[model samples]
Target: MRTVRNVHARVIEAPADRVGALLDRIASDDDPLFPAPVWPPMRFDRPLGVGAEGGHGPVRYRVTACTPGRSVRFDFAPPADGHHRLDVEPLGPGRCRLTHTLQERQGPGQALLWSLFVRPVHDTVVEELLDNAEHAATGRTAAPPTTRPPLVRLLHRLGQERPVAVPVPDGARLARTAFDRTDFSDAWRVPLDPGMPRDPRAWRDVLPFPVMASEGDELLLGQDARHLDFRASLLVGERDVTLSTVVRTHNRLGRLYFGAVRHVHPFMTRLVLRRTRRRLALAAPAAGSRHRRREAALG
Candidate 1:
């Protein structure tokens, strides 16, 4: 197996010292690299550190070494073979650059997996991590749309998952549930307008687009359009909330639809997360009436 390596880098708008401290305090809160306690379940058996083991979905890795703020490395666990290194370098007084590199040996049939899925997913995930870091340091994150080549676009056309979580607004449970049923759902639920259908031939309008499935904290909704099954689920967690979509193609038409927009999918996912967070922040009134009263009185 020939050793294959890939490197991804991003700049953060924060002091090198701050970024280093932020990376070292890896308690799994808002680390976009780790799965949020939402859908598309991903977990680390324990906290990240030397010898700790964890994986998200089918991906797994074992920490091999660490240097707190400067760098860390993880050796791929069995069934997978690789070394992933994350490091930070100083840029200036209030800025720093970060990099994530993956060097691996394709084992067994791993080469196909790497080319087809792992590599693409890893690319997106690394970018997401950079965004997360910037968000942590400066409260904003963005990059130009990531363009996918034909093969990658074709691969994503059949399906893709965008998982993200945001802090749920206070007393906004009903707002969240209702939003799922309105134009937000319409975005992925086909017609773009699920308003009352006016004509008879509008057969697709008759049934209530499913509020699909719900259990305890999670609520799911979707519409089965002709060419594909467009589905989304919203999970209400004690501390945060999340949504993810499943795009299942029915035939050629679905593939065509997906291929055209697969590149946009990840970008849209980030946009959705940003919007959700902004909305939540706005809707969440400041707590502590005593503090508010003092400011009001002073005014």
Candidate 2:
């Protein structure tokens, strides 16, 4: 096994207290530090304090210590031997230094993965966090923004959430009753991230067909063709969005056409949903702007 220590630090123009306060809100609903939507959001089971038991994406860790506005430390779970921490130090009356340090003991396999993949992503995230801290504390970042490499971007895309097959929702009434005799039906769903739009109307562009009907939180779209009549429903639920498809075959010609299409339908639907989710996530307001909006409202 080999031991690895990685460190990233930046100086922010804002006062130490201001930068530290921004750190204190990490993983909160209004977090203005952690880069998210582009990367996985840092999260904990409860709040940002000792014993909070959650980690971003597949990482599993628990907060071991915290000093409110100054520092926080997290220890990794089993199979991983390490701790990562963030600290804020007062540089002067109107300046502060923020640092993130991660140290881990890795086996050969783990080390290989880290050197090839994890390290690049980790470095990017830490830099982005520092950038966010600078922006939230002073309304702008001092340095040029970090740019993701092609490999990192590819890895990020590969790690994107994929849709899962699910039964058509009962709430999708228009889709459920689209055809007098349903020849085929299927549904797939993907989760909605915190800042994603929840209105089904916002997802109307998921399909090329014109909107046929809408109710509650569902929008139906499709066309009646010579071969088959089909309808697609986009339902935005409390925590997820479901895409459902229903088809009615008029005769042997419809059945023949659909038989060939069904094989690729699953792959196409999943790809479309994943792409749409990522697009919308990237389009959401940045965390710093959102935090400022909330503060403005509160004031």
Candidate 3:
């Protein structure tokens, strides 16, 4: 096994207490420091404190130590051996330094994976986190924003969330009754993140179909063609969004056309849904802004 250590530090033109307050909110709902939506938001099963259990995406860790606004350390879950930590230091009354360090013990395979894939993504995340820290504390980043390297961008795209096939939901009444006799029917779904739009109308533009009907949580869109008549449903639920398609054939020509199209339909549907989900997520308001809106509503 080999030991791997990585460190990132940024000097913020804010008091240590001010910057450290941002650190304390790391995995909270209103986190203003950890860059998210583009990257997965950091999450914990409970509140952000020692013993909290959760991690962003596939990375799993448990908080083993915490110093409130000053420092926190996470120990990687089983199958991975390492700990990563963040700390804040006072430089002066009006300035502070924030640092993140990651150390892990890796076998040959793990080390290779880290060097090629994990390192690039990890470094990018750390730098972006620091940039957010600077912004939240001083209203601007001291340095230019971190640009993701080509490999990192490619990896991120390839690793994006994928849609899963599901039975047509009963809640999609418009899609269910769109056609008198259905020849083909299918549905695909993807989870919605915290800040993602929840209204079905907001997702209507994902398909080129004309709006057929809409009710409650589902928007129905489709076109009647010479070969086949089809209906597409976009259902936005509390935690996920479902895209469903239904088709009806008029005759042999319709049957033949749909028979050929159905083969590629599932693949195309999943691809489109995944891409649109990511696009919407990236376009959502930042966590801090959303949190402020919620506070205003409550107030």
Candidate 4:
């Protein structure tokens, strides 16, 4: 058995039909608003349509009922025993109120589990879904969606989890905003430094800590486990640089899992850490040899 959860929202300056169409089109392109919660292009069975089995994750649903411009209902698709409903009603000219409700079946003892375990996870998904809907209805984009790191947590089943990767501003080309200036492109490149210890064979052995990567003038950092976004450009002394990264954690089956962006910087960091450790090990013997040589000469 699953406890029922409901979330309601209002969409201003948009009619029910217009809003409905946007939701229908969500599977077509890579919506910037709902980057992580993506669904593959769908094939509809009817006019308030239902699509075939598709999408990347365990989350799936099929539209059970739809009244164009009025409401839509989606039932459990698979891997989830949940159903969601969306209702749109006119508020005034060029405006409408939208309501969304989510309900799921729970087995015996599920209430305790939901209250103690699943509430937070459900809250996040509901919140994120509403955020995507709101942002899509409005044409504007947040300069920085969030400055906070992605929420990371441990799960009973999955070690540590985070949100999937999402795009952020490219620091190199971004014009200076009043808020941020620490662009990634201009950030210090730790691995490239001559004095830095590096390992050619294994990256983790070289760079133990995380480092940033650049594209054009943009600095990008992302961790898929926590669903966190960090995009800030701080004016350091003179040059404008950007720091943008997302750490996300996804909670499933009462367990948390951890995964960072698999990219060049992380790769380089691992390599550098490995080689540096190796070099230190080899240098230790030489230091002893030198000490013995000096002592022998003195004798």
> Candidate 1: where is the Cα deviation over 4 Å?
25-29, 32-42, 145-299
Per-candidate clashes come to 1, 0, 0, 68
lDDT of each: 0.55, 0.88, 0.87, 0.41
Which residue segments of model 4 deviate by more than 4 Å? 1-3, 31-48, 77-82, 140-299
Question: For residues 34-150, what per-residue lDDT tens digits would candidate 4 score against the true structure?
Answer: 223121122334333655334323445677776765776778775568777767777776677667787887676766767765565555444444455555565432332322113
**lDDT per residue as tens, model 1, 107-162:** 65788778877688668656645655666666555665345556655554333333
Candidate 2: tens digits of C-alpha lDDT, residues 1-299: 99999999999888989988998899886688888767777888898999999998898899999998899999999989999999999999999899999999999999999999999999988887887787778777778877888998889889988899999999889899888899999999988766678888888777777999988899999999888999999999876899999999988999999999999999999988889888887777667666667777899
TM-scores for all predictions: 0.50, 0.91, 0.88, 0.42
- Per-residue lDDT over 1-299 for candidate 3, one digit per residue giving the tens place of the 0 to 100 score: 99999999999999999888889888876687776777887889999888999998899999999997799999999999999999999999999999999999999999999999999999998998888787777766667778999999999898888899999999899999998899999999988776788898888777887898989899999999887899999999877899999999998999999899999999999988988888887688755455456556899
Query: Candidate order by lDDT, highest to lowest?
Result: 2, 3, 1, 4
Candidate 1 lDDT score at position 259 = 76
User: What is residue 15's positional error in candidate 4, in angstroms?
Assistant: 2.8
Error of 1 at 261 (Å): 34
Measured on C-alpha atoms, candidate 4 has an lDDT of 0.41
